[model samples]
Target: MGPITVTDDLARIDLDVVHRWLSTDAYWALGRSRETVEAAARGSLSFGALVRSDDGDELVGYARVVTDRATFAWLCDVYVAPSARGRGVGSALVRAVLEALEPMGLSRVMLATHDAHALYRRHGFGEPAHPEWLMALQPTPAASPATPAV
Candidate 1:
């Protein structure tokens, strides 16, 4: 594997690969649609980790942050390709993201992960300081336009 290069260039992303990885492999995004993925990328700050080979640069990892670029950010959809795991690509990606956001001096950055707690802890991510104060609502999926509501 070649040296990994992390960049925030959205043009460098291969949406097909990202959708495949998330929709098929990622637990949090299983069955997610390409249109949804595209929309998420469009609305978030995106990063891609690439490696150059004779075949040219290939995107091996991705992450996105939803933020107002001021006081709050939510880091989500972080993924590293199977071929790219165990080689520090994930760390590099997260480091680049935090570095890019440091200037904003955001009050908080947050993410939720079923696994990778240790990895995130290495980058200063911890359980919420006030979990009791937080609440979430996950609404049921809306009916499709073709489906009549009961």
Candidate 2:
């Protein structure tokens, strides 16, 4: 994880890299337009992980929280670039987001994951006690502009 840094500064995020990952590599948000992504970024609390190299710091991981910053937060769009994986980038990004939210007085933070349950589990996220009450207004696949992949 050498020289990797996590920050909540939206200005520090590299939109091109983030848009590329979400639009192509990431299972979620595939084929999402750059404009849509930029809009989403502006509406969310953004976190980015960067790896410092001779070329300077490159954005390698990202996560965002959609919240009113009062009572609830939904963590989404967590992704790490392929070249930056296996170096704890994902962990760093998640932890950073959590830390940033610590002072917001939020009562709950939620996220949905298909296969990375273990990663989130280590961060204190667990199965909801009232799973039966959880519901979504998810649009049909064709109707939705964004979809969750892996």
Candidate 3:
């Protein structure tokens, strides 16, 4: 495999590959729509990991961060192509992301992962210091319909 280069250039991202990976393979984003993916990319700080070869550059990984660029950031949508797994592409992409955000001196950066805990821990991520202080509100799909008058 060629050396993987990670960059924050949104123009370097291959959205088709990203959408396929997220919508079909990523458990957290299964069935996510293309329009949503496009809008997310447009609204976030997007990164791409590219492999440079004689054939040119091929995007093999992607990540995006939603941040105010000052106080907080949420890292999400991190994915690496199957072909690039075990080759450190994910690590490279994440390292690049952290480096890019270093200047902001944000108070916190957060991410949710099902199986990448070890990978993230190696980069300073850990269980929340105050789990009781954190909470989430995930609206159920069934709750969207209008209810009858009580």
Best by lDDT: 1
TM-score of 1: 0.84
Question: Which TM-score value belongs to model 3?
Answer: 0.83
Local distance difference test values of all predictions, in order? 0.81, 0.77, 0.79
The local distance difference test score of model 1 is 0.81
Clashes of 1: 0
Q: How would the candidate models be sorted by TM-score, starting from the highest?
A: 1, 3, 2
The TM-scores of all predictions, comma-separated, are 0.84, 0.83, 0.83
Ranking by lDDT: 1, 3, 2
Where model 1 places Cα greater than 4 Å from the true spot, the runs are 128-150
lDDT of 2 by residue, 1-150 (tens): 467799889899998889999999777789999998899999998899998877888898999889998877888999988887778898998888878887786666778766566677666665433553221222222342233211
lDDT per residue (tens digit) for residues 82-123 in model 1: 998999999999899888887887766777776776677677
Native-vs-model 2 lDDT? 0.77
